[model samples]
Target: MLHAFLAAAIPNPGPEAPPGLGDLTNTILAWIKWGCLVSGVAGLMICGGMMILGRRNRNQLAIEGVSSTVWVFGGLALVATAAGLVSVVV
Candidate 1:
């Protein structure tokens, strides 16, 4: 009886099976990946501008710009690796 229940609960993923929830999840993840990439590029541009503007002043704006740039890149890397991370966990 337990084996029958388990088999019923986990259906085999074959070609005949219609699209599953995993398909929707993959679509959403793809959109999120693109969004992250665009945002990271925008952040880099803004930070570069800040760094340039700070060059003429005696403030620490350049340092802030560098830190923000690093954070944006890190976020991009995380988003890019999400698939591999999910695979590892699951």
Candidate 2:
């Protein structure tokens, strides 16, 4: 049949990774993970500072700081689960 001929014409080479590419990718991923952690911590600290400064009178800053905490935590959660998520999808 035409379907069989077409299937035969197309060869399926599943998942070919170049040599050393995996190692390079892993190194990059590690760097990114560390960067994410550092940034997340810095973001939390900045948010805390904002809340403290705003507590005196500027309620808006305090509210903004509180809301920003959620975003920081969300980013941390995503970073923490990134590997697992990739594995699940792949």
Candidate 3:
């Protein structure tokens, strides 16, 4: 994807644009694409971790530890899903 964009991005240097000039918009778009890719991967990992964590015995562990782990891991998974969706949209 980046390769195709870069291929076409070769500037037509003239009075308007200097030699070797490239579009800033493409740079910004590339950053956004990279960020979204990272977000999706991170979300996937979080969901995987959540599955492992959900299988663990919470109550059988300790009162405080169980409660906190449940809330934290659950919340993290939710946030990860949301981020992944947002990345897809943007």
Candidate 4:
């Protein structure tokens, strides 16, 4: 179904609407976007350093922390995506 729509309509990824605190969805989307980005970056650093840092501490603990960060970031991303989907449908 989605593939058909994309095929029928000419894709115009024009200028994106400016962000504002006009609605809950918009606010949540912004939060998710930023949160995911920050957490993703932090995850990279933590995971990269785990090789060295884990030797001094518990490897499992560090890995668990990174995994948690990934889950949080992923959840935030899901929220943003769901909001966007609702907006489009409406």
| lDDT for each residue of candidate 4 in 1-90, tens digit (9 for 90 to 100) | 998998789776644555763576677777867877777677766665764466565887667666666675776567558757766875
Question: Candidate 1's error at 3, in angstroms?
Answer: 21
Residue 42 in model 4: shift from native, Å? 2.1
Whole-model alpha-carbon lDDT for candidate 1: 0.82
**Model 3: per-residue lDDT, tens digit, 1-90?**
998899799865433434555576567667766776676567556555555555657533344443455555665466557647765665
List where candidate 2 sits over 4 angstroms from the true fold: 1-16
* TM-score ranking, best first: 2, 1, 3, 4
Top-TM-score structure, candidate number: 2
Please give the distance, in angstroms, between residue 41's alpha carbon in candidate 3 and its true position after superposition.
Answer: 0.3
Best by lDDT: 2
lDDT scores of the candidates, listed in order: 0.82, 0.92, 0.59, 0.68
TM-score of 3: 0.39
Candidate 1 residue spans exceeding 4 A from truth: 1-22
Q: What is the lDDT of residue 5 in candidate 3?
A: 98
Clashes of each: 0, 0, 0, 0
Superposed model 4: Cα runs more than 4 Å off: 1-32, 69-73, 85-90
- Give candidate 3 misplaced runs (Cα > 4 Å): 1-22, 58-90
